[model samples]
Target chain A: MTTPTSRTRLSPQARRAQLLELGARLFATRSVEEISIDVLAEEAGVSRGLLYHYFGSKQDFRLAVIRHAVEHLVEQTAPPAEGEPLERLLTSLGVYVDYVLDNLTLYRSLVRAAAGGTDELRALHDEGRFALTDRIFREDAQGEILTDTPQARLVVRGWSAMAEEMVLTWADDPSVMTRDELLSVLALSLPALVDLT
Target chain B: MTTPTSRTRLSPQARRAQLLELGARLFATRSVEEISIDVLAEEAGVSRGLLYHYFGSKQDFRLAVIRHAVEHLVEQTAPPAEGEPLERLLTSLGVYVDYVLDNLTLYRSLVRAAAGGTDELRALHDEGRFALTDRIFREDAQGEILTDTPQARLVVRGWSAMAEEMVLTWADDPSVMTRDELLSVLALSLPALVDLT
Candidate 1:
């Protein structure tokens, strides 16, 4: 029999996507600081120069992985259009919690990387948070109570951080509180924060 | 002419403290993952083996740095004992904000390291949070309105996260809102969280 072929060339777009998928898997448990470009290239079965050619640099590659994961999350957990503002928020929160719990490792690394004080990662993380905040604000604005102003968005940003902490704390130890209770706590806090702002 | 002395020998305790101080300064701008032991030893003018002798591993060294910083923060921002529960909290909040704003670099690295997902650092971060929560809870409990219980402490824990986000957000960009406004937002949210819990 002929020797088996080891590789098939992929289109540029397909190759980048494939590499990002592998990078995401590695980044799930480890921060970019812990993983070297050489290791990433080896893991993807490409030369280090190929990695550089494709992504420009390790930092650029890390950003791509994060952006890809965030886009995937936003798509999967996009809230339904038809519900009361609170109802939509609760539904979205439930889906978010499920997603977070399902990918605890990746979520942990995302938080770790975001907090690592890198300007690029911090900006990416903030963009993701603001996107969710905007969604919630849009729903809340529809209720005709809180107008979608700069101040309103700022409040939503703070609320988003609280919600994040709620999910993270619960995911860290679900035994401490029921999921329903956790969701309720976050939901109840939102209106008060909105009113305060 | 007598040979000029370049350095002096120090006691073990003083030497360890000196090394930790140097390590903390470096760590303020970089995560432990990014700072190698060799660099640290070289910066301290000590041998790598001496560093190993002082700290079991890089992880151990990181914990010591974090511990020292936390202790220093607690001492400097210790809330006054004589005031209403809410009054004490507000005063402590001001002091806490000053401390954070003053040591922005170290605080950033501390938050970064804590979220870096290491068990030891996470434990240290949690302990620091709990200590602050306990202080707030003691004052709140004095009012006999919210007794210190596991459930009550849980609420404080969640509140602590929000307060942390508030402080971090403020530190990241002071132009977004006045310091008083941020503190007010946090202070107002406290009653609602306590009520819900």
Candidate 2:
């Protein structure tokens, strides 16, 4: 009989990605504290020892999951290359709406982790948000859409916070408003927000 | 010793409020699924039989907790009687900020429940939001701030959603922004949002 190949044959990146995806699904359905390493290992078809071997501990596993979610959000909402700053911002908002609708479970998991009082988890959550805010600030400054200053930083942060809250509400009720309708509202409000006038 | 007063002597409203307050505290720290009638009774320092006698069932108890949180939010954010519509709206936002900050644990619990897929819970969540949105919409309409139609409703929903998300972010990091800062941002943006001209 041919010798069976080892599970380690899979690359580290692929394994990490798989673990994150599984963790998101589980965390979305139940509280983080309620989930156990044994359940995760069983679900993943890996031994409990192997699961711990990869993630080190349950908390580390959660952190990895949060990082994955953040990375996915950043990739989805990256600003477009060629458009008016306003148009680019609207496009980004549209992307966010689509992401939230498609991944409500994962998005809620991310929001829960961020909102809960875990410093490391909170830092991971802010990483993606700050990145998106920085890009918006850069584009607005380049196009003279906003005055460059420390105060402008607050505008970006405020806008980001508003957009996040809007998405959460939308996720709660898709029938309440279409994604484009929501984005249009933001687009109309953004010029005033950035003080384009 | 004198016999304890019968259940008839206790006001139902007061008893219901007591159960809700206890439920909120337990749910905030633990999963809803993890919380049993027995545990809630024990935590409240009441007998399990009395707990059931008050709430009727676990589901009813959960609903009561959600309703209590919603009512508390409404009470805090009631519009100011004598002010410019804009001022009233901003004042309302400030009140909301204060409520969330003061009741951080309970607010977080309500948010988590709303995000979870529970229809009754979500309706309770939206009722509070709609109450705030309706006030803003009426102000906008009376001031000729926004076109009166479904489109405007979408804008109101978006703005309300953004406000909710901002509160969650603020709760996570109180030092990052102040209530005044948030109100100022909204005050500037609302006109652009509500005023079609």
Candidate 3:
């Protein structure tokens, strides 16, 4: 019998949040398919019954954990509202690149999970992508660099896909380029695709 | 009840190829999961047993049809090895964009199937993507425009994703840009990201 030192008493909501964070962190190292309710419960020092009570099923638990991570990621990459549009865009891209690189394992696992194409998981991934795209349109509209038209949105969205590919490839093996080179290429890529001169 | 005019007097290999072409065409309008062997046989003026004999199973049939389409796509978009690199890239991109636009229904279905991420299907998609990217490096290296570095390959691959996104979105609704405009934007985008200036 040992004390639940890490998971010491918390309200149910707090405990659930803590468990999701733990799951997200663990998912970085362990695949979602590999980490079942038993593993999660054991890792969090909770009973399997309590986890089922919180999430209802393994599928539900996986979705919730990914949802939590996506929300945190979206929140983390929000553009600062007070800077010049270009500067703000660069700042956000810098953070986005660094976040993905820093947690490359989690990011790669997340893509593999989404690529596995579980319907709810894929939907969650698309929703997160759209949310970040929306944020770019809304937050980075302070200058002429970004416009609010559907065409502009399409260009930016396409650039998002490009940057994602570059960052993911670079993060997979950083020796392909230096971090600063990768960041500069990404920063230049959007305006270039949009042909903003 | 009808005469098997199209199915008459063919070798077994030819019949299988015909059915695969039929499957690929139908997949343009129907999801891979939705079409059944009975329907294929009915449409092909053959028996379900023959279709099964040729394909072994529905999964095998799906992979073959997708593999056929992807191979055709890679071939259709190949750059000319005899032209100026810039002209060659633009011409290949024009063909590439036109191919996607003309085959919008098939292209969308193909992506959805790939996104569904069946193991062989996803691997086939990646193989096709890498094939196209490699073709660009080999065919476009005649001039000083494209260097054959890992970093350069990374840039072109990222541009491939960018162009794919842009073309798919625009093809979904071409009102986004004129074909010439989309072609120009895509052509300019690669050099821009590669920092050719």
lDDT of 2 by residue, B4-60 (tens): 322335587777676677777787777666667887776766678888888888888
For model 3, residues A32-78, the per-residue Cα lDDT tens digits are: 67877888877777788999999999989988998999998888988
For each candidate, the DockQ is 0.41, 0.21, 0.46
Q: Rank the candidates by lDDT, best first.
A: 3, 1, 2
DockQ of 1: 0.41
The predicted structure with the larger lDDT, 1 or 3, is: 3
Model 1 C-alpha lDDT per residue in residues A1-197, reported as the tens digit of each score: 11111165779888888878777878876756766677677676677888899889877888898888887777777888887777777778888899999888888788777766477888889888877777766666655436675555566677777777767877877876788877777777777776776
Global Cα lDDT for candidate 3: 0.79
Q: How well does candidate 3 reproduce the true complex, by DockQ?
A: 0.46
Q: Give the lowest summed-lDDT range of ten residues in model 3 chain B.
A: B1-10
Question: TM-score of chain B, candidate 1?
Answer: 0.85
Clashing pairs in 3: none
Candidate 1: misplaced stretches above 4 Å?
A1-19, A29-58, A142-145, A149-151, B1-60, B142-145, B149-151
For model 3, what is the alpha-carbon lDDT of residue A15? Answer: 86
Candidate 2 lDDT score relative to the true structure: 0.70
Best by lDDT: 3
